[model samples]
Target: MLVRELLKNFQELANKEVEFTGRIRSNRQGKNVSFLVLNDGSVIDDVQVVYKNETKNFEQLSKQRLGAVVYIQGKLVPTPNRPQPFEIQAKISEIISECAEEYPLQKKEQSLEFLREIPQLRPRTKTFQAVFKIRSLLSFAIHKFFNEKDFVYVNTPIITENDAEGAGEAFVVTTRNDGKYEDDFFGKKANLTVSGQLNAEAYAQSLNSVYTFGPTFRAENSNTSRHAAEFWMIEPEVALNSLKENIDLIEELIKSVLSYVLENGRKELEACQNFFDDKLISRLESAKDSKFKVLDYAEAINILKEAVKKNKNEFEEKNIKFGLDLGSEHEKYLCEKHFGSPVFLINYPKEIKAFYMKLNDDKKTVAAVDLLVPGIGELVGGSQREDNFDKLILRSKELGINFDDLSWYFNLRKFGYYKSSGFGLGFERLVMYVTGATNIRDVISFPRTPNNLLF
Candidate 1:
């Protein structure tokens, strides 16, 4: 399996002979000469193969289909003066596999919607090739970021009886008969976890700095582009950390991740630039230099009210007083007009947030934060957990949650107490930020959105 990276060999080859196998992306035949474009995933660009009468398979290669695979032995030579830098002067060539005339992918453009239908074959196309490559590079960058910072990577449980996010909607993990769960998991009732905050918090208390990067499930019925039944979350928790410290760590983490992807995956970024506003890369780079704007819930309300007065809000107001959940529309308006980039909306009203959040001095707001990007509304959501036993139990009761199911979690606060703060960064949303991808479905390989499970 000899493979060559065409770009790596920039210098003119001095009668260098090489043997390689690759797919024929394009083909052309002249009176006495034939040319074939070949690529083997070793590089994004294809190398040109020039075959002459010295090869008996010239006729076979000339009649090959567009996507057929072929093997060629050739001497690399400079193009002399042409569009390409070099060309392969083939001494011998043979057809490895025939791609029949019915091959779906031609050398023409296809709509993303149409391409989505052929998920199994989309990678052969240039756009998806770049997208998936960027996806791999970004995942590596995320792991590298935490591993270098001494954050222990923790694998949290996927099936549980608990809803860690307290969102009340989770897909039940059951082996049932006709949707009846009486025979599932010993009839104990289990569901896929929506968040790993509680489990990750336990580890952070011991490991000091820990994180979980895994798939999380939610059964919410909202069929929006941002909502998904299954998605990847990057949750990082730190011990003895204040709310302000949590904000600082998040800003640093996001900036570092963006910088890594931008530097390592520039080609993919450029390939998909037309999908977003032209200022996408520059906007991200500018965020690295600018300070993140931090505002409390009250301050945010004030800003919104001011915007409303000035008619800056283009959409309908949802009675967004102080204690309401901000929708995606409101969030985008805030970041786009008020903040100009990434903003940390912190100290949310405790009654609206989860029970585990630490109570602030105001007794009304919790130590919570949601990082809102300009295009994507909420990129990361996190908070400092309440370490006090009595307060935690009281908050749990206030939220009408069954304390018996969470006895083990409370035991941590009862015995060994340590303050911890963490946040869940939506992995797909991060990709959307880096690539300017609009829908969450486009970023994930096979998105499990509502009513769409064809894959």
Candidate 2:
């Protein structure tokens, strides 16, 4: 019986003979009796088994190592005053796989760095067991939210010639037969996609609403806690949508998924809270209940400048001006310190934004917004796309992006271009925020960073 199932039907299974198989999490040998905790990865909590010296093979089973896998036949007995509500009285025990004495994950706390060295085995730890379970639930929650709203899930291409962000942070896709990439697989200079927005936009124009949830690659060399070479992105595009509508969609999606994880993933959440962050659940509850703030970029800049002058914070980059692109520290100050909740910083200067963002009436700034949260700085980045073909061509030229490479994308605007917008949310960052895991590496099962790719 699975631990989760046993817990759900404990009243029915009480005083009944049962059988189960699981790995031993802990073992203790006493003079008259012994205790063994078994975990089958069905849930966060393990099952407790008790056996005395008279039970079959009790001597060998009681001396099993921490990671030993076993099969057991037992009777469920209620323990009203014990830590666990019910305990298993063993009748027969079978060793499925005997563990060596060198198991790394013992009944002791281990540092995150030390566990990271053994990524393959880290899932057996309580911390990652909770983290990965929450991560999986969060992914399912995102798909459920989009599907319920009648959005078509589109799978975008992995390799492309166009860089949607236009920052040139792409991992070049190549097949080097003679020490150079002269023979490209796609017969062009191809690179992994930075965003799926451009492709999702074409589909959204026809389908009304569409979203792409897949892996995105970036070749940036920065080794920050938030930066990863390969990550998953969630991009949602909708035709005939305004910037305000886009913001509303984002807020709804965030709140919906957060509520789902908090309500349904109580076991995982409690485990994470007890181990990682004591206030993790309360923080998530606050985010779900509180109303997100909206502030203009100009006012945000002014507030940041005033904060610097008033000695509110010794900002690393103290010169917070109008045209300056805000960093993590500035975003944290606005969302965490200033507004004390999630805030949408809107209408940034065109020079600091992408070329596809719609140019404002002033022609100086563009229609862009970034969602900033308390613990995590930027959770989502979105904008209203430029629908005018002539303006788009001019903007691309102004940014020095080759027109030939993006001519295919421009064709969509040429035929029937309507106002459309979308946003990209980093999947790993979302996992980090929900799990209260401080480092990005802790959230992902296998992290890809600069000069680091382990199998």
Candidate 3:
């Protein structure tokens, strides 16, 4: 029987014989009996197993090392007024496998940095057991949210020719001995895709709604606590949606995911609260019910400028002005300090935003928005796409982009154009927000950072 099932059905399974196999978390040997705490990774809690010297295989079982796997056939008996509700009274027990004393995971507190060195074994720890469980559930909730909204799941290619962001941060896909395009795999220059929005757009134009969840690569060298060499992104595109509708979708998505995790993942969240941040649960709970604020990019810049004037040395990069990109510090001050909630910073300068965003009537700003939260700076970035073919071509040429390479993308507007909008949310950042794991490396089971890729 699975430990989780046995525990959940304890009242029904009381006084009945059940067999379970799990790794020993802790073991204590007494003069006539032994106690074992076993975990099978099905749930957050472990089941206790009681064995005596008279039980079968007592000699071998009692001498088994920590982390050893064992099978116990026993009856469930109530443990009145204790932490654990029930324990197994062993009728027959045997050691399935033996672990040497050199087992890396000891029953002691280990630093997160130390655990990073042992990613292979870290999942067995209580903290990771909770974190990854929540991660799995949240990922499911994402699919469920989109599926319920009548969105089709599209599996876009991992390799492509167009730089969607046009930031030149793509990891080039090249295998030719002489670096010649004719000898490459696709017979043209290609790179690991940075975003699936363009491909999702293709499916959206046909299906009216589509989303892509997949791995994305960035070749940037900044090794910050938030930056990773590779990450997962959720990009959804819909036809005939304006910038306001896109923001509404983003807000709904955040609240829905948070509510699902809070309700279905209560145990995991509680465990995380006890181990990591004390405010993890409260932050999530408040976020789900809070009224999200919306502020234009120009107004946000004015607030930052006034902030700098009042207090010198407020921000690290303190020169606050319009048309300048908002740094993480500026994002935090606006969300945490000013609004005390999530804020949508919109209508950024055309020069700073991507070429695909729709241009406003002022001809200087684009309908781009970034969802900024308290602790995490930017959680989601989205925009109303440029639907006009000629205007898109103009912006592409102005950005010094070779228009021919993106003709396939612009052809969507050429053949038939429709109003559309989409957004990209970093999966790991969402995990960090939910789990309260500070560093990007801690949330990722096997993080891939600059010069640091380990299993």
Off by over 4 Å in 3: none
Model 1 Cα displacement at 358 (Å)? 1.0
Q: What TM-score against the true fold does each predicted structure earn?
A: 0.93, 0.97, 0.97
lDDT string for model 2 (165-232, tens) is 89989988778655354466776788899999999999998999999999999999988889888899
Candidate 1 versus the native: TM-score? 0.93
- On lDDT, the leading prediction is 3
What is the Å distance of residue 65 in model 2 from its true position?
1.2
Q: After superposition, how far is residue 351 of candidate 2 from its true place, in Å?
A: 0.9
* Prediction 1 global C-alpha lDDT: 0.84
Better of 1 and 2 by lDDT: 2
> In angstroms, how far off is 79's CA in candidate 3?
2.0
Query: Which residue pairs collide, candidate 1?
Result: none
lDDT of 3 by residue, 298-398 (tens): 99999999999999889998888888888989999999898889999999999999999999999999999999987788999999999998899999999
Sorted on lDDT, best first, the list reads 3, 2, 1
